[model samples]
Target: MPAVVETYQKIKDLRDKDKHEKQKDYQSAVETFEEQAGALYEKLREKEQAVEQFNDTLSHGSVQAHAFVQHRQYIEHLDSALDDLQPSVQQARLKMEHARHVLTDAYVEVKKYEKLIDMKEEEHMQWMKHEEHRHMDELSMNQYMKFFNR
Candidate 1:
């Protein structure tokens, strides 16, 4: 192969490796985001359940004022924590999407280089075949001339 084609092949190899790494990063990011979202939802559910239980208690009988205030405060705290966690989950999702884009670009680059290398190799093979045929024709012509002269 020509040096230029070899160089392209090397570049393609590097891009392929980069694509692999990007895929792994994307997978990890997705997993992290999923875990974060799951935890957030679980906490939200717990908070909801707690509020429902508190309401049921109030409906059933008379409750103390301090206990009511404390339950409200606990619910508020859970709400605050959920609010804080939402942004981090969004950030993780964004990171995963970005990684996916990078992986896609790397895959395209590798394919482009692969096509270029294939074209170059095909051209080299055709040129070699043409040269071999020309050489054979020349040898045939020489033999014909020798037989005619004799």
Candidate 2:
């Protein structure tokens, strides 16, 4: 409960709050990236399935020529779109990783501040105990002198 310990406690509280906010941000980033990747994969699967079904229909030998070309072009467009999305997904993953690192650093800072506060409190407690014992000794010596003199 010394002034120094109080200051350290205040710092620790601020650091802990910062750490909590960073943790939340990291978790949100992770969830966002995961959802994006999952949706992308699902879309890729659907596109691949569509292309396969179109190929199967072509083998039936009753499709119109224009419809065939249009289907092929649409599949090519889907491929290009998927390719374009991949870099954005990669960027999201990188952003999530950065958030995780920032959260970790914030947590470390909080712990260090907490440790410092604990050490300061311990030192203060020890000093208080030493002062109390010295005061008690002084009182006891005064009483002993008074009793002998009387």
Candidate 3:
């Protein structure tokens, strides 16, 4: 029938849509990672330039007791920033991995649930078959009684 065909087509279309959406999400995550990496690299270059500037300044000046203190402090700040950046970038990558893990877990769960449903349905069908046979036996007995009375 046309209705049956239409329903099948709709189911297929919905599955296709879901597949496309998942692909889009994967592409978007990759783009985000690339953009973050590029920005981090640019910031690293800028930070390096700051260190170079500080070193050049120190070279030009006569060494003073306080000058080393300031130089050390500047380098410390740079090191701390880099340290912080590492954890942040790592966290993002970890999030991506976690998302993948969650999807895998869901897939595994779906298979288990599907198997459970099939088992339940099979049991239900057996029960229905037994009930139908019982009813048919009762019907046959009632018909025999009616024929004898006639």
Top lDDT hit? 1
**Model 3 regions lying over 4 Å from their true place:** 1-9, 94-150
Model 2: number of backbone collisions? 0
Query: For model 1, how does the per-residue alpha-carbon lDDT over 1-150 read when each residue is reduced to its tens digit?
Result: 778789988999998998899889989989999999998999899999998999999999999999999998999999999999999999998998898898889889889999999999999899889999999999999999999999
Question: For model 1, what is the C-alpha lDDT against the true structure?
Answer: 0.92
Model number with the top TM-score:
1
The predicted structure with the larger TM-score, 2 or 3, is 2
**Runs with alpha carbons beyond 4 Å of true place in candidate 2:** 55-68
Tens digit of per-residue lDDT, candidate 2, span 87-118: 87898899899999999899899989988888
Tens digit of lDDT per residue, candidate 3, span 46-136? 7789778877887898668787787778778767777767776776677666655655555555455555555666676787889999999
Count of clashes, each model: 0, 0, 0
lDDT of 3 at 59: 84
**Lowest-sum lDDT 10-residue window in model 1:** 1-10
TM-score of 3: 0.47
